[model samples]
Target: MVPGIYRPRAVDRTLDRYRRSFSAIAIEGAKGVGKTATARQRAATVFKLDEPEALAIVQADHRRVLDARPPVLVDEWQRHPPIWDAIRNADDDGAAPGTFLLTGSADPRDAPAHTGAGRIARVRLRPLSLAERLDAPPTVSLAGLLAGDRPALDGDSDVDLERYVDEILLGGFPGLRRYEGQTHRAQLGSYLDLVVEKDFPQLGQRVRNPDALRRWMTAYAAATATTASFEKIRRATTSNDGDEPARTTVIPYRDALRRLYVLDPVPAWRPAAGSLGELGDAEKHHLVDPALAARLVRATKGRLLDGASSGPAIPRDGTQLGALFESLVTLSVRAYVSAAEAAEPEVRHLRTHRGEHEVDLIVEREDGDVLLIEVKLTAVPDDRDVAHLNWLAGRLGDQVIDRVIVTTGRAAYRRPDGVAVVPAALLGP
Candidate 1:
């Protein structure tokens, strides 16, 4: 996490493999997720457009990027929007594979002229996952699970509930790893502050009252890991005088935050074949990282571990610790699934329309195979805990390749019922 030292990222392997065939690869993510660090490894020619002088130079001659060395890296390239079109044009001119690497913290307000679907590829980078942050390599493979081979689960993790709490507080951000205590909390707070003070304005969304946005964000954080209605979330942000922000005003704030990558919501899962009836259409709320959620609601280790809940009063099923833990699990699974070779694997949540059945995470492969997973804050999950996972497996039948429960346990093993119980730390791509 030190400035000079570079830690290995899951995206590193993807970038290396992709650069061989793709003419351009755009690595996109929220700020401080280490896009530049990862892209710089593959870049020979670098244009740090974030710098004022560099921006001026690029602004004057945007086409200069097309002539740079193979594997050109345009850091924070949104500073000059046309650079994307220039790269696309060069790709059309038969540019060789690995011709460009564009890294941006946010999408440019000025839209790209082309979708670049065939010309360029995109790789997303997120805050470090639980497996990425730990010392030991993970033993259980999410890729293996998606294969439907029912592989043996074997590994022991030293990561316990307290350690997970620590991770939730410290978060997966690369540079923020070195900070601890009040400094760490303050740094997280400051990061959120920047989103309000700079990122929103840069994205062309005016913040008339930063405090109101912050409160809404805090309420959204309180709704982490739940398919809470937007109206409910908005209502949670209401004032004592029974006044609420209008929907028209709130929609722009949500859209702008999404554009800034400040919000990472998990869309509800609906089976493509329509075998599962009437699925919920709501999205489970989450921030870019659980540490941000923790910071937004001011959740501390003791408060989270002791089953304390507070903040904007959004209704949810479990304890504050449990929701944040699910958020952490979601982050880890998302990071792993992105690196998996399962062919268009997606991370989503599943909830029946009547709320009779729901699972924390679902990795639905392109071929309709499902790896249904549940998250429990405890080290051990009883029958009641995995009931939904079992029910979904029964519903999906052969399509349910693997049913797993991600937990804070010390060991990774399979149950007699044929479900896999994995310590979150032991899971990898």
Candidate 2:
């Protein structure tokens, strides 16, 4: 029996809705995002491939596990990637909907022969959103915005800047949420350590110098929300002798990290059908979770409260806390947007070549309509805060479905020009 509380995930609804039509569904995310527990709730018989006994059985005959029951779950299925094709073959044999469920923490070392496109639907399960983490419910729905319904933006959350700092340090990992102080800090530290020491090697790329990899990771963490170039990060991880690893050497590290789902950077947005004048191609740096980033830079709540910044490893526009807040918002937006699968919006970042204008988050519909949002770590958003939103609105005209400034403010309201000002706590899926 799975023990402990199961906080309802936003993806639960999506999983339920999709499994009805698809034969299999794969829930993918970073480790410890509660993928197993969430899948267990729907599974009858589970094959935990990570375990020796279960793996031994699968090795003996892969079909043995499949014979246990229908609606069978194969946890850590990436451990034995052939199971993916086994399930795919089952689907090819006309298996009933929702017959097989697979959950993976990281991508398999060997890629599956088949893509499982039509037979198995893949849903991304990310960390908990602000609404899931907090007691008070969100007032504004992301789905509503995507629908262009323009619902009333009215509600309040006591989750201020200080509380946001607490959330940033606390992180969104379900199991680790209850820990505080040094214990919590240590757990996050160990999580990062495992990523470098174990997770990377498991993904088929052995780090010859773990220390160098850790430094690179720390430097990347320091980059957080900025679009800091790879050259900058390479220099930051320089050795004491002032020698840095070759760019060729560091390239594989990012590939490995990405495959492990450690880095979740937002790609630059390009309008599908327009000349938007030199949209930057660089991706905005972000880890899977903000707390992991905070832990990498050793950002304590007290230090963050004091407006302390991390190492000069990467150049940043504002404070680390602010960047983290944007990251937290990005996570929430992705979660909310993912849940709105019917009219799912593609979330990306926007930046010009000269860096004259930039918006933190862009939610673009399949039809190319967009909802632009700017995340601020402040209580009240004045005209200065909404300047970029205004600028983008002028450029995009009616193509801009909505403009928003997400802040740590108390209330959710809109300005005279129709740009919505929303508190992060008050926004939901």
Candidate 3:
């Protein structure tokens, strides 16, 4: 969806770099996350497969893709899974570098015959990050912080708690940026409705109980930022056939949602070597954007600001705003690291097996160094707030480069104990 202005995303840099060397780069993400727009920027020719005429043309002869100019974009290639093989075959038949760009919204169950391994390079295009949203010129560089240098942390932000809550509910889906008030709310609701009503079926998965799926989604939304088990979330809804939802039924719903890039769960952090001492392997549940979670839980600005817990009850540590704030921070951090050209880093959460101490995010570099982060709702970092950070820092010693607290406060600075406190709006890639 090309929406007038083309706001730069963190993934743009990665996509641009990969396109020069790799002939086929598949930009994959959820629907309406600017996949088409990002790919269109670098594409010499575009195949709009979602359109009827374009589909007919492509279906007639997949080899027609070979005729387009360099950087030929196959928008929604999943619309025709054969295009993948066609592209791969073209690659084998001496296609030049930067020749094909594919964008996919849904990962079809019947995937392309070829896994495209060593042939097609895949890049994820997620929702806009905090910095990409251009809320404020990001003062702190995540890349800089991850460099293990004690960078001078200093920035001021007017983005208070209330504004952060609004941002959380508004979400970071770039296409929905222009809509406001009732229209915006309606669009988000319709987005969720479409996932249940249309997206599920289009993925070739049958939703026997749409209401149950919606409730499950809502319940999953409630479990945001928490490691709520699938069983707990599944129990929140009742199937049309009665009795608790079966695993056979619920697994499809979860798998389909994942294929749609709707449910972005953060996998538990496992150290490459030098064990973190029995870490928990439970994945943290998070929607693609926290705003989706807010929407599913019907978290209004007033309700969120008032700290009213909405939607199905799932065990969590803090207020509704706090969870979404962590989620908002999670999205931003993930985007930042994804764009980082440094030695392949990843974003993960850390929790001990016993659950005594946990870090909200663990940005670990290729060398086993880590940036421990804890997201808090308040601005200042107290001793109580930095307890886990301090504990992990002492345990890891030199491996712990930076311990940070992402907040909705007005300023960014470091505590005497070396834990940095940064406003969510001021942090960037």
TM-score of each: 0.98, 0.97, 0.96
Off by over 4 Å in 3: 1-3, 238-243, 273-275
Question: Residue 229: error of model 1 in Å?
Answer: 0.5
Candidate 1's residue-wise lDDT over 188-213, tens digit each?
A: 98999999999998888898878778
Q: Which residue pairs does candidate 3 place in steric collision? A: none
Candidate 1 differs from the real structure by a C-alpha RMSD in angstroms, to one decimal, of 1.2
| Model 2 C-alpha lDDT per residue in residues 1-429, reported as the tens digit of each score | 123978888888899888899989999998988899899999999999889999889878978766768788998888888889988998888888888889998987696978899888998888888888988889998888877766668998888788998888898889888888999999999888898888887788878888888788888989999999999998898877876888888898988888878899999998865666887889999999999988888888878888788754578888888999999999999999878868567899999887888999999998889999999988888898889888988888888888889999999998887888899999998
lDDT of 2 at 50: 83
lDDT of 3 by residue, 79-123 (tens): 889889988988898888889999999999888767898789888
The TM-score between candidate 2 and the true structure equals 0.97
In model 1, the number of clashes is 0
lDDT at position 177, candidate 2 = 88
Q: Model 2 segments beyond 4 Å from truth?
A: 1-3
